[model samples]
Target: MNKIKIIAKKNQKEIRIDKFIKDNIRQNISRNQIQKLTISGKILVNQHIVKKNYKIKPLDFVEIEISNIPTIRDHLEYNNIIAEKINLDIIHEDEDIIVVNKPAGMVVHPGFGNYQGTLIHGIKYHFQNSNMKNFHLYRSGLVHRLDKDTSGLLVLAKNEYSKQCLSQQFYYRTIQREYRALIWGNILKEKGIITGFIGRDPKNRKRMTIFRNDEYHKGKYSITYYKVLERFQYLTYISCNIKTGKTHQIRTHFKYLGHPLFNDSIYGGNQIFMRKKYSNKNIEFLKTFLKILPRQALHAISISFIHPKNKKCYFHSPIPEDFQMVLQKCRKIFLQ
Candidate 1:
């Protein structure tokens, strides 16, 4: 284990916690690493946990402890992950990159109890069949990720150079992504931008929530722009373009906006909001729609990014049948 301790003097007052730690500690941990430690309570001020942006005052004591436990990645060996043959919907493939239309219910990569039937396994199998060079099972070739239930276009690099270039594009926010989703309530705004700080829910680690006003210091800044595509009596279809890609960002932001994604199990969208009056027919239709679309009604519809070869690449994925079914049902039933 590695531990760092610092006591702030008058000269260090008001210095941001992350910067303060970086300057005081000999370790070269990054701002993001510091933020994660703070969030997880591994970093503390005056024996009390603080956010990454907390300002250190005079006599404030900061402690950081890094555990030596091996991560899940370290435990994974090449032989541990058997490359079971699985179909990959390869949308675009070239020497440097592969763009795939990932389907709902498919895990992007394996970890913990899930080590098989993942996209990585499928890709490994594909690489084996093609005798691709410079392929490593551990690398997985993934640059970014979509949730297991979120179907969309995902780009995979074929080698280290391509991976580095693509990863930088994502890190710098030079890549463009667009999504389509159906939410539980009709939005009055034709177009709007939602801004808030997003972080893990203190009570539930599995979910994310937005913070505003006094709680703004709790999470990283996130921005989501949405335009209403269609509105029904009980739900609305919208397109979302996110400026920041925080975990569960789209789901959390819309939930904060009072319109959780339809059928989203974790963010209060799985149940009907009975506050609004619903006709018996509409109620029945909603139940049926929920069954039709069991997952969150979100889809990554498009993405655009600069290729490693200095060219622009854009790809669009049509809405899946499940999404189309619910939308069709909305038109036929909710519009009646």
Candidate 2:
């Protein structure tokens, strides 16, 4: 059992007591558990038991007694390595939506190999004591996702209504998704669009390809508009905009264009050089000086869409750190 004491600061005034406890507590407790504690009089605001709906005021002292705290683990580490909490940069947030800068090498959702400690898990830990409910399954308020290796702006729906609205916009191809990437080899064209039907490569089941003839797979229509932002000796910095969101659309299209991402392994680029130069001997060594950039060199730099409630245009997210590092390396190697 552990106890936490919270003193509301001036900026935290008018914040809900439950929210305060949720944000401050280090223990791995669920929102449902926090609400249950509040109902059972296990939590006190200013020395008086209050309902879950009570909003905290400035200088209010909140105390919470947590019992039977469970040990949190991150299964993604594979060798019992715990997934550490990463500081996510929030570009924008409101009652309806949240936009965050997702870092590279972080999986967005839990999957077969990643059973615990993902982006969703962190959001759940952050909102564990709020009035918000039914979000446990969704893990935070995520409406859309960015691939684990691909870092960029991602949006989360604050409520079910917003989720449905935002999802519809994506389905209707109304949302504007943009990406910035460092592709291998110099691109001759300054601007162009790539359009084709994309599906899984028959020979390589792990990757997507622009299939010319395949009746069974039923490839989806995909399009991407790209403009060369800058050029290096053998690499090009390009800005990409996608009208349709297919699985690995930007990466696949770039692969078809004969200029795969700089360090992409699945689509084949210069991963061997990166791995060899960065050290790929053991896990510890890889995690150290090498930097675990296991995913492709692409990022969703920004996303713009209309607000469901007000129909106002909104944009969010920023260039991830890993991408920035890659850019810096390019500047040092080619520009110098």
RMSD to the native, candidate 1?
A: 5.9
Q: Please give the lDDT score at residue 55 for candidate 1.
A: 87
> Ten consecutive residues with minimal summed lDDT in candidate 1?
67-76
- Candidate 1 matches the true fold with a TM-score of 0.79
> Residue 38 of model 1: what lDDT?
66
Summarize candidate 2's per-residue lDDT along 117-225 as a digit string, tens digits. Answer: 6776556544443455334334444556677778878888877567667755665567888898888777889999998878788898888999764442236567899
Show model 1 residue runs off by greater than 4 Å: 1-79, 137-139
Q: Looking at candidate 1, what is the lDDT of residue 268?
A: 89
User: Candidate 1: which pairs clash?
Assistant: none
Per-candidate clash tally? 0, 0
lDDT of prediction 2: 0.68
Point out the worst 10-residue segment of candidate 2 by lDDT: 68-77
Candidate-wise lDDT, in order: 0.81, 0.68
